[model samples]
Target: MTAVVALLRAVNVGSRTVRSAELKAVATSLGHTEVVTYVNSGNLVLVPADGASPDDVAAGLSAAFESQYGFAVPVVARTAAEWELVVRALPFRAEAESDRSHLVVYCWDGVPDVASIRTFDASVYGNETVIWHGRETYAYYPDGIGRSKLTLPVLSKAAGRVGTARNWRTVLALQKLAQERS
Candidate 1:
């Protein structure tokens, strides 16, 4: 069984909400064992059912969320080894967590267009930049995300893909969870 983490995008943020406990239950039903949730942004750590692909696990959770909430919520799954690589590749691991604006984890559904990531216009963001590491893209904006010109909407428009962004602290916390289970 491979350890996988399912990261839900835009769930439980404002008006549209799904309970974290329910997310855990849904994953459990899908044959994921030892399911654990961290925070409310839909971060879950579990061991995928034997022979279940990442996409299979994601689809099960996404379908469950849609049926329960009456809306579709996209889910991104990362293996424990994959997440550990992301943590190790962090450009500024020692930087204060609060200093960075947001950390975007791009779902690895399809091939990411390199041109799209580089063509992004963020001069207004100054120090803020985007780095594509495998399927996930990490962005650091010195200014607040709300104020920064590089918003999630902008990325969606340019990249033509769905993604989720959490604060740096949240990313690290997920990393810690991976370590604990490992």
Candidate 2:
């Protein structure tokens, strides 16, 4: 029973609302045990039934969520071990320690196109830093995300894949939860 960290994209934002309780119910219905959700933004930690792979759990959760809520919610999942590596590989560790809210980690369904990320013109964003490692992208907004020009759409376009962003603090919290469950 390996623990998996599942992140649902764009939920509880705008009209695409997903209640935390309903989210937990959906996960429970899928046969995952020890289900835990952190906050209302779709951060979940659980043990998959029948030793399902992280990818399989992600797909099942996405499908179940869509069926239950009548809206598609893309999910990106990682094993507890993989999530630990994500924490260790964070590029803006110093910035995260200082201002966690300004440093976010974006998790994609799969590794984005490396060449596209490498050629992105980040200078236009002004002091923002973006680094790709494994299936995650670490971004630091020195001027705060709301004031920065490096929006999610811009980064997604550059990376060639859409992803969900979580602040450094949430990232660490989710890691801890998944680790405990594992």
Best by TM-score: 2
lDDT of each residue in 25-74, candidate 1, tens digit only: 88888778888999877889888888577778888889988887888788
- List the global CA lDDT of all models: 0.74, 0.89
Residue-wise C-alpha lDDT for candidate 2, range 66-166, written one tens digit per residue: 88888889999999999999999987768877888899898988888988887887778899888888788898888888888888888888878868889
Q: Please report the candidate that would top lDDT against the real structure.
A: 2
- TM-score computed on alpha carbons, candidate 2: 0.96
> How large an RMSD does model 1 have?
2.2
After superposing candidate 2, which stretches have Cα over 4 Å from the reference?
none
For residue 163, what is the lDDT in candidate 1?
64
Query: Which residue pairs in model 2 clash with each other?
Result: none
Against the hidden reference, what TM-scores do the models get?
Answer: 0.87, 0.96
